[model samples]
Target: MTKCEISIKMMNSTTPSPSLGYLTAHQLENLVKEHHRSGWKSLHMEEAFHLFNKMLTAKPKPSIFTFNLLLIAISRMRNKQHYPTLLSFFNQMHQAGGINTDTHTYNILIDCCCRMNQVNMGFCVFSGMLKRGWSPNTVTFNTLIRGLCSKVDITDAIHLFEIMPKVGCTPNLITYNTLIKGLCDSQNTSLALEWHKKMVAQGIQLKPDLITYSTIIDGLCKEGATEKALELVQEMIDKRIAPNVFTYNTIINGFCRKGDIQSAFKLFEEMNEISITPDIVTFNTIINGCCKVGSFDKVSQTFKEMLARGLTPSVFTYSSMIDALCKGGAMDKAYEIFQQMVDTGIEPDSITYTSLIHGHSILGQWKKAFELFKEMVDRGLAPNTITYTAIMSSLCKEGKSSEVI
Candidate 1:
């Protein structure tokens, strides 16, 4: 049977099979307690289902807490594929009828629904929680808000944020952070800032954390307000919140996008001064920026520094360097870098291949360019418009204009 069919079957059948035998309520409780203490690190889905079945037959049945522990373990599993199974098991527990489901249990179900992208169902679960006379907590509101945000339903998310206080749930730092991030992600950075201002006004207890600063800084950067982002960085430091490598990378990328390589380099140096080790992303952004301005010397220097820091170069790292070398008319160096990338098990994407093709075409090496084009196609990479234009340009330069099509 398919997995879904099995889940349906499990949900409908609560009668304990005689062959599996039964455990006393104490034994089942101890088993769940042990797993809970371990943070469910080693609990497998099959073992969880087995425990649930055993619970069905245990004398006096396990308490709701024990059942919730098993459910929590399932939810915590790294593989999200089991989330549906968790919901199924919850249904089985509800249908069997004696255990009084608690607020925590409803929260878990609501979370599962939201994670599964069934935000409507999550709201239904919320309504059920209210009907059950269970008070929704901060986690409950946060999960629903995050779900709405994930769907880019910022209106509903904001509405929910406004109603939390009426429901006797005070919005916490996490709640504010989630809404801020949602607003920023939806390209409403201005409104996101308004919310940030509101968060700050809520008193010292609701002070913005590092995540809050970093997220808004990133949004500002994306909106081409690098200077404003820089000011916020200072504001954060003044508030005793140290910016991490990701924060620096975001601003550096913004400066690079604005074609202000000088400012990008300044941030790169500031990271060194602050003892925040530059990560691969930092080097890649610097290298790409340097490439754009034909600053090959800086590219070489930053790439060497990245390797010196024991960071393994990603495909993007190799691709940027290859493109830079190709554009600089250093075909020999570009070819060497391409080979090195392959030897390091980094596959060249269409951009990488297109760069090499264009480089060879510029050098009047039409034959070599065609060979790379064929290789790229054989590797299942589709030639984009730029790639086709490069080949046509090479053909036209070779006095083969008739073959341009």
Candidate 2:
């Protein structure tokens, strides 16, 4: 018995002078009908099928509406703990004159299965939908596409997209967006852009929504195609699709990553001119860019501006600042900021510790650097290869070749 069943049985036993009878077939049908007519919010599966024997032996079997209603209730079930109840409910519904396998119905099941990460079951349902001679619609294709995409099956998703037209379902914007995101996530930026162009050539007007623009720009940045990313931003603007916060952040971060702090600051000024209020991510990107170029004064100014603009600095902000201070040979200042980070409740992680140790090692402060290294290990932070190499290189520069090995 399911937990719900056990709970219902326990509740029944605790009632005074409990009505000790199971629901008759007639009562079951009537209760199901009542629940269906009045919105299925209150139908308990345990009560509906208490007398499983009589329900299965009913003279005129339950209708399809009865089973579908049960399925909807099953879908509303939020917890996996109700899976047994649901499986039993589906089994009984199938046995009770319910054609429990249709395209729409299977789509719902596939969605639930995908959300639960039961990919095999979802595929099984898809096969069942095909074998039943039910033509899968665009919505069905979209659901499966999304499911495959969620599992990072970009190749399968693209295959499904290509097959949609053959299946008499033309791809829509949602389908394109799904496939584009999948391709972008896999760093297949060129292919993703090719599809975007195809989308436009097929007379699908490109609006360059946040996700669409962000994906392409991010892909270009990862490939160091910052110039192309900037051009696309202009293309989006020329197409009259207003750039949102994500769009600006992507461009700013791209410039920052390329160490082009001047262009990043220029974009910041442009953002303000466009009446786009900067968010914390915007500040973090500019601050990070300044830090990369060793422009501590500019970093400080941006940090102050970020605070004055009522934006809260995130962990990235603190990380970048600590990294910048350390890079500028200001270990004392870096440690002071590290203490302030703890004062403000931001816990330091491996990257933060690595930055400080790397700075001291570079300056030949072997004792201080090793102390931080031991402290890092004691605090359960494992230094990565970069941290080890930094220390080894420092020791080698001081002719400590034996220790370097």
Candidate 3:
């Protein structure tokens, strides 16, 4: 009774794969979860849906396990910009009595709703789940807390956080991390620190993770408490909590913004000594600092070092180099790098083009400047107000405004 012709077309699905009919429902469910658990970009949501649909063609249609698997796949859908279809699927499953809606099912649904910023709908689901005598777990609380924090509803998030213990669900590390990050983002680092202390005092967080420390360090650094951030870094190191690229990048960026490039470089060197390979962000940060300090040689060396480590530089990297070269009055060198950037398939953005155009205009190279300006426009990049003013000023001074008309 299997219908090969019965195909469900998902218009918004990024990877529209065929319904996998080869595997059993259990195997299909396992594969779907494996894909979801692998990483953010690993799961193909459309294919998972298709597999679930494919399962319906057989006897003993997908159990709650398979139902939850489809839900999990939908929750981790990468193309969040697409219209939400998970709720529709949930409703279909619920109406058809295909499977029993358990605590896990509601948890997934609530998490998905919350992630979509539809926290009210998620709460409705929670109320329904509770009415059915299902006990909500820490994940249920964490999902809502995290969602509220995302919407800058720190007060509600805190209210929920405080009531977790009262509701028979203890606060986990994720609970604290979410609130701490929310407070830090609201620039209320003092209160975040208080919670951090409370988390430690509870003795539950005896072995805090990188996020726990990094969140506090990020807040301290933003508050111009770089010294305090450094102390936390040392504490993290002492506790053997290895700082990831993001953790180091945060502190390095803070130093660079504070105009303390020397300290940034020192931190960069420390990262190497600690066997933490620098990421693209790390190199980009240092490159930016080098540009500000007019250390062109160091900038070039860093670029080479980045390549030597098998890391491809970003569009920002090439753009920054071109800007630095232009600022140094080396227009020919800037043009060379710009060409190289294009050859590497890195199209220059408005800022990069403006840097080159302004440099050429300053040196009375009107033809070259105009060409760069035209190229920027032809590429569909609308010139900003500053870019237009700078280029117009150059052309008007050269009595070439008429030429534009």
The best candidate by TM-score is 1
RMSD of each: 4.5, 7.5, 6.6
Model 3 whole-model lDDT (C-alpha atoms): 0.79
**Residues 216-240 of candidate 2: C-alpha lDDT, one tens digit per residue:** 8888887878899888889888877
Q: Rate the local accuracy (lDDT) of all candidates.
A: 0.87, 0.73, 0.79
Error of 1 at 174 (Å): 0.7
In candidate 1, what are the lDDT values of residues 141-163, reduced to their tens digit? 99999999999999999999999
> Clashing residue pairs, candidate 2?
none
Point out the higher-scoring one by lDDT: 1 or 2. Answer: 1
Model 2 TM-score on a 0 to 1 scale? 0.74
Candidate 2: stretches off by over 4 Å: 1-99, 113-121, 150-155, 204-210, 378-382, 388-405
What is the Å distance of residue 9 in model 2 from its true position? Answer: 24
Candidate 1: Cα lDDT at 333 = 93
Residue-wise C-alpha lDDT for candidate 3, range 25-132, written one tens digit per residue: 667667656765765365455555566555544355657776776677666664454225676666666555656789899898888777777777778878878998
Determine the C-alpha RMSD for candidate 1 after optimal superposition of all C-alphas.
4.5
Give the CA lDDT, 0 to 100, for residue 233 in model 2.
Answer: 87
